[model samples]
Target: MTTGLLNKSTSLDMKHLTVFIYLLLSFSTPLALASEKKNILVFFIDDLRPELGCYGQDYINSPNIDALASDGVLFNRAYCQQAICAPSRASMMAGQHPDTLGIYDLTSPLRRTIPDSMTMPRYFFENGYETLSFGKVYHHHTDDREYWTDLPDVPGELYANPRSLESIALLKTQAKTRGVKGVALGRAARGPAFEAADVEDDAYRDCAVANQAINALQRSKDKLFFMCVGFAKPHLPFSAPQRYWDLYRREQFIVPERKLPQGAPLLAFTSWGELRLYQGIPQEGPLSDEQTQELMHGYAACVSFADAQVGKVMAELDRLGLRDNTIVVLWGDHGYKLGEYGLWCKHTNLELDTRVPLILSAPGFAKGERTEALVEMVDVFPTLVKLTGGDIPESCEGTSLEPVLKDPGEATRPYALSQYPRGTKMGYSLRTDGWRYTEWVNIENKKIIARELYDHRDSQESSRNLVELPEYADLVSTLSKQLDTHQRTAARKVKAGQ
Candidate 1:
C-alpha cells in the first residue's frame, strides 16, 4: 500500500502537490502549531475611502480591489475607531479604541502612551510568526520598530514631477523675500494641490512600496510571515501617473454642493486646513468648480493607481503559491471626505470620515460575500488572534469577528462607534441599524454641549441634524443612554485591568 501511494503521488503536478501540502497542513491543524502556521498579508491604504467598484461605486476603476472583494468577505459597514491616521492605525494595531490608547494626534508617541501594550505585530511575533511592515503602517515610520522582525524602509518623495518641485522652490524663494526663513519657509512652500504627471507607476512612491513587498513575499514564501504593505496614494496632493489620470474624464466628476448641515454646531465642521496647505487652495471659502473637478479627478486617478499596486503584490502572492493557506486582509486606515458637506478632510465624527473599507479572505471561510455586519477597526486584532487559534487577551475591547468570517450574515455587535476631538471637546458618534447619533461633550466635565442626530434611512449623507426636533426626541434619548452605558462599561473593564 505504501509503494502504491508513492507511485500515485509521483504522477501529481506541482500545483496538485502544493494543494496537497496546503490541505495536509490546514485540515484539523491549529495555527498554533509552528510547522503548519498560515501566512498573513495585510494591505494598509492611507486616506482610502470605500469609493471602489466593489462598494457599488460605478465610476471608480478598481479592478484589483474588486477582484479581491469577489474572493473575500467585504464588510459593508466597517468603521475605524477614529478618522485621523495616527489614532485609527494605533487603535487597530493595539487592538483597542482611541480612548484606551490615549492617542488622538499625530505628535503623540505610541510607545510613551502605552509602553506595555501588546501590539498586533509584537503579539504575532511572540506566537512564532515572522512579522514585517512596509510603508506607512503607522503615521510615523519609526513607530513600534522594536516589534517587527525587520525594520521598514522609509518611502521616497511625495511627487515625482519636476515642475512640482520647481513650484515649491519658487514658493520658498518668494517666502524668503518676505523674510520667512528655515522651517517656516518650507511650510509655506507647498507644491500644486493635484498633478497628473506623464510618468510610469513606478515613478510614484507607492509602486516602490509594492516592489519591495513583492520582493519580501519572494524571500519569505517558505516561512510563516505576517507582512503589511501600505500604500500612500489618494492621501494628499493627489499625484499619480498620467495613464491612471487618463482613465477617467474630468467632467464625470461632480462637485459636492457646498452647504453646512442645518442646526449643526460650528465645531461639527472642519476648517480643512489640510487642503489649504497646498498652493492654489484658498484660505477660506468654497473651492471653485474647476479646482474641485481637478481635485476629484486627481483623487480618482490616485485610487486606480493604488489599485494597480495592490494587483502587483497580490499577483506575486499567487505566483509564489501562498494564497490557499494565507489570510489576506485589506483595509483603509480611515475614510476621507472628497467634498461632502463642503468638507475636504477627515477630522469630524461624520459617516464619511469614519466608515472604512474592510475585506478579509481566509481558508475555510465564506467567499465572495458582502456583509452588512457592523465591525470596528479595533476588532481586527482580536479577530486575527482568534483565526490563529490563540486565546484572546482579556484587555481587548473588541470582539473577535471569526463568526462573521464563517457566516457573512452573522451580526457581531449592536452598533459601531467612533470619536473625534476638537479643542476641549470630544465627540462620540454611534451608528446603529438606521441612525447616527453624535454628542459633543466637554472633555473635563463630560457635559454634553452639542448633539447631532441623522436618520440614515432617509438620506445617505447627514443632510440635517434632528437632535432637537420633537419627533425624534425619544429615539435620541434611547441612543444617548446606550452610548453612556457603552462608555461606562469600557471604562469599568479598563479599571479592572480586564
Candidate 2:
C-alpha cells in the first residue's frame, strides 16, 4: 500500500512539470517576437501630387520613388482631409479629420484645440518604440514636441545657394520698405520663381535629412525605431540642384490650362494669394506662358531632387540589412496645383489639390501592387499600428488599410472627404468612386450657401459644376445624402471619443 501511494505522487508531479514547461515556452515565444518588432520609416514629402512615373506620369524623373512604388503598394486615389498644408498634415498625424481637430487654418496648433489628443508618434512612443523626427514632419512650429523622444531637427532655410539666398534677402528688404499692407498685396519685390544652383545634394536641406535618418537607422539597430523624414522641396519657390534641373528640358514642360470652370461658383476659386507671395510672380494676373513653363520645370526638378533623397535613405536601409524587417511608408502632405485651372497652389477642394502620393512597403506583402481604392490620409495611423503590432488609440478616426495591403483588390472605404474654409463659409467636398460633390456651408447657421457637383464619368476635368443640370438633380440629391451620412458618422465618432 505505501509503494502504490508513492508511485501516484510521482506521476502527479511529472504532469505538473510538463504543464509549467509548456506555458513557459508559449509566453517566451511571444516575447521573442515582440523584441524583434519591425522598424518603421515614414518618408513624408510636401506638395507632391501623384505625377510620378509609377503613377503614369513618365515626364517626371522620379526613378527612386517609382522603384519604391514597385516594391510596395501604391494608392492612386488617396485624398487628404484638407488641401492646405497645416490642416492636412494635422489631420494625417492625428488620424482624425480637420473638423474633428477643429483646425482649419495654418496658425493654430492641434494640441491647442485638442489638448489631450494622442498623436500617432506619441502612441508609438508609449509602445516602447524609439521615435525620431527630421525636417518638417509637422507644419514648422506647430509640431507636438513632447511626442518625439528627442527634439526634432530644424528644417533649415529655404535655399542653400548663395545667389538664391541673396535674392530672398533682397525681397525681404523690399517687403519691409513696402510695409504689411504692401506685402499682403504682393507689392514686395519678387524673387525668381525657380533656381538651379550648381551645388551638391547636401547643399540643400533634404540631403541633410537623409543623412541624419541613415545615421539613426545605423545606431538603432538593436531597438525598434519610428523615423519620420520630411522633405521640404516641390513646395513654393521650387529650387533644387542644377543637376536635377538639367534632367528636364524647359520645352518638355507644358503649361496647364488656365480656363476657369464654365459654371462653377466664384467661391470655388481662390485669389491665388500663396503664389502671389513668391518673388517674380505677377501680383494680379495670369502667368505668361513662358513664366508658367519655367515654373513647371522648376517644380518637376524639385520633385526629382526629393526623390533622390528618398532613394538614398532607402539604399541605406538595405545596406544596413534592415530592408526586410523595416516597413517604409512614403506620403505627400498634400498635392500642388501647377497652373491647373488658373490655380497655382493647393487651396481648393479640386482633385488636383486633394489627391496625394501614398506608397507603403511592408514585410510579407506582395510587391509592385497598385490599388485604386479611394483612401484618405487619415488612414495612415491605424495602418501603421496594425503593421507594428501596436495598439491604436481609441481616438483614431481613420480605418486600417491592412486588408487592402494584403489584397490590393479589396475595397475598404467608399469615399474620401475634404474640407476648406472660406471666411464664414466652409466648403465640404466628398470624393466617391464615381463622383465628386461639394457643399459650401455658412458656419454661423449651418446653411448651405452653394452647391457644386462634378460627374467623373462624363469628365475628369472638374471644369464644370453639374449641380444645376436638370438631368443630374437626382444624382446630386443622392450624393448629397451620402455626404451627409459621412459627416454624421464622423461627428458621431468624434463624440464617441474617437
Candidate 3:
C-alpha cells in the first residue's frame, strides 16, 4: 500500500512539471523574438531617377544597386508625394501627404508645421532603437534633433573639394560686385554647374557619408540601430571625382528629346529656372546641344559615383555579418528631368520627375523578385514598422506594404498620387494601371485651371495630352472621379489623424 501511494505522488509531480514547461515556453517565445529585432539601414539618394541597370537602363553602370535589387524586391513604380526635396522628404519621413505637412517649399521647417508628428526615426528611437543620421535625411534644420542619437556634422563649406569651394567664393564675390539682391544673390553664389576633379571620393560630401555609415555599422552590433546615410550626388551642380567622369565618354551621351507634349497647356511646363541658377547654364534660354550633352554626362557620372559609395557601406554590412538581420532600403528622394520636356530639375508633376527608385531587402523574404505595384513614398514608414514588429500608429497616413513584400504578385493600392506647386496653383496628378491624370487647381479659390491625361499603354513619354479630346471625355470623367475620391479619402484620414 505504501508503494502504490508513492507511485501516485510521482505521477502527479510529473504532470505538474509538464504544465510548468509549457507555461515557460509560452512566455519565453516573445522574449526571444524581441531580442532578435532586426536592424534598419536606409540609403537616401538625391535627384536619382529610375535610370539604373536594375531599372532597365543598360547604359548606366550602377552595379552596386543592381546587385542589391537582385537580392531583394525592386519596385518598378514607386513615387514621391512631391517632386521637390524638402516637401517630399518631410512627407515620406512623416508618413503623411504634403498637404497634411504643409511643406511645399525648401525653406519650410517640418517641425513648424507638425510639431507632434512622429517621424520614422523618432518612432524607432522611442521603441528602443538607436537612430543615427549621416547626411541630408531631413533637409538641414528641418530635422528634429531630439529624435537622432547622432546628427550629421556640418561641413565648413558647401562643397568638400577645395577647388569647388574657391569657385563658390569667387561667385559670391562676383555677385556682391554686381549688387544682386534677394533670390538672385543666393543664385549667384552657386558654384559651377558641374565639376570633375582628379581627387578621391572623400573629396565629396557623399563619400564622407558612406565612411561614417561604415563606422556606425561596426559599432552598433550589440544593439538595434536605424541608420540613414543620405548621398548628395547626382543632384544639381553635378560634382564628382574625375574617375567617375572617365567611366563615360561625353560624346556617347545623348540629350533626351526636348519635345513638349502636344495639346498640353503651357502651365504644364516650366522655364527650368532651377537649372538657370547655376553658373555655366544660360540665364534665360534653351541650352546648346553641346551643353545639354555635357550636363547629361555629368549627371551620369555622379550617379555612378554615388553607386560606388553605396557599395562601400553595403560591403561593411556583409563583413560584419549583419546582412541576415538587417533590412537595407535604397531610395531616391525624387526623379530628375534630365533635359526631358525642356526641363532640368524636378519641379513638375511628370513621370520623369515623380517616379523614384525604391528597393528593399530583408531577412526571410523572397530574393531577386521585382514588383510593379503602385507604391508611394509615404508607404515606407508603416512598412518598416510592420517589419520590425512595431505597432502601426493611427497617425500614419500610409498603407503598410507588408503584403507586397511577401508576395511580389500582390497589389496593395490601386493608384499612386503625386503633386507639385507652381506659384499659386497646385498640380495634383494620379497614376493608375492604365493612365495618368493631372488637374491643376488654384490654391486660393480651388478652381480647376487645367487638366492633362496620358495613356501609358500608348506611350510612356506622355507625348500628348488626351483630356481635351471629345472621344476620351468619358475616360477623363472616370479618372477625374477616382482622383477626387482619393483626395477626399486622404484629407479625411489626415483630419482623423489616421
The Cα error of candidate 3 at residue 181, in Å, is: 5.4
Candidate 2 has an lDDT of 0.86
Candidate 3 overall lDDT versus native: 0.88
Candidate 3 — which residues are off by over 4 angstroms? 1-13, 156-163, 181-184, 494-498
Better by lDDT, candidate 2 or 1: 1
Candidate 1 residue pairs that clash: none
**Per-residue lDDT for 159-219 in model 2, tens only?**
7667766876787776677664543534354466678889899988888888888788888
lDDT of 1 by residue, 170-198 (tens): 99889999999887887799888888889
Candidate 2 stretches with Cα past 4 Å from truth are 1-24, 178-190, 458-460, 495-498
lDDT of 1 at 282: 97
Tell me the lDDT of model 1 at 164. 95
Q: What is the clash count for each candidate, in the order shown?
A: 0, 3, 0
What residue runs in model 1 are displaced by over 4 Å at the alpha carbon? 1-36, 181-183
